[model samples]
Target: MIKIHLSRLLGERRLTQADLARKTGIRPSTIGDYYHELAERINLDHLDLICEVLNCTVSDVLEYIPSHKRKK
Candidate 1:
């Protein structure tokens, strides 16, 4: 499973979803979806923009955990 750590990163950086959306030139709704992990799939271009605005790598916002590796 893919986990989005956007909320965690934003909280740590004291950034709001609207703030990030403005900085990344992305719509707040779209950013919200990503933040809440409600989107069916993530857009890489949007991810790049987010990383650029946040000044962080993709790993800072996302994590991949295989089913076998998931905690019981």
Candidate 2:
């Protein structure tokens, strides 16, 4: 599973989605999608903008956690 840390980061900074959207010039809906992990695909350019606004690295925003499969 790909885990997004956007919500956590925002909570740490006490920032709202609109706050980030205004600062990054990104659509509030897009940022909301990411915050809820409901985005099917992410634009790298948008990710870069978000990182810049949050002062965070790509790794800090995203994480890959391998899922465990059931054994027969």
Candidate 3:
């Protein structure tokens, strides 16, 4: 599973979904989707924008875990 750590990053940085949307010029709904880890797919451009805004690398935002390693 691909896990998005947007919620954690935002909380650690004291940022809100609206704050990210304003900084990155991404739609608030889209930011909310990522923030909640509800997005099934993500645009690369959007990912780039998010990383830029968060001052983080892609790995800081996303993580891949093998299915066998994931808890049910």
Candidate 3: where are CA atoms >4 Å away? none
Where model 1 places Cα greater than 4 Å from the true spot, the runs are: none
Per-residue lDDT for 1-72 in model 2, tens only? 788889999999999999999999889999999999998888999999999999999999998876663222
Name the better of 1 and 2 by TM-score. Answer: 1
Provide the TM-score for each candidate, comma-separated: 0.91, 0.90, 0.95
Pairs that clash in candidate 3: none
Q: What is the C-alpha lDDT of each candidate?
A: 0.90, 0.91, 0.96
Candidate 3 lDDT, 1-72, residue by residue in tens: 999999999999999999999999999999999989999999999999999989999999999999989976
Separate clash counts for every candidate: 0, 0, 0
Model 3 per-residue lDDT at 7 = 98
Off by over 4 Å in 2: 69-72
lDDT of 1 at 66: 92
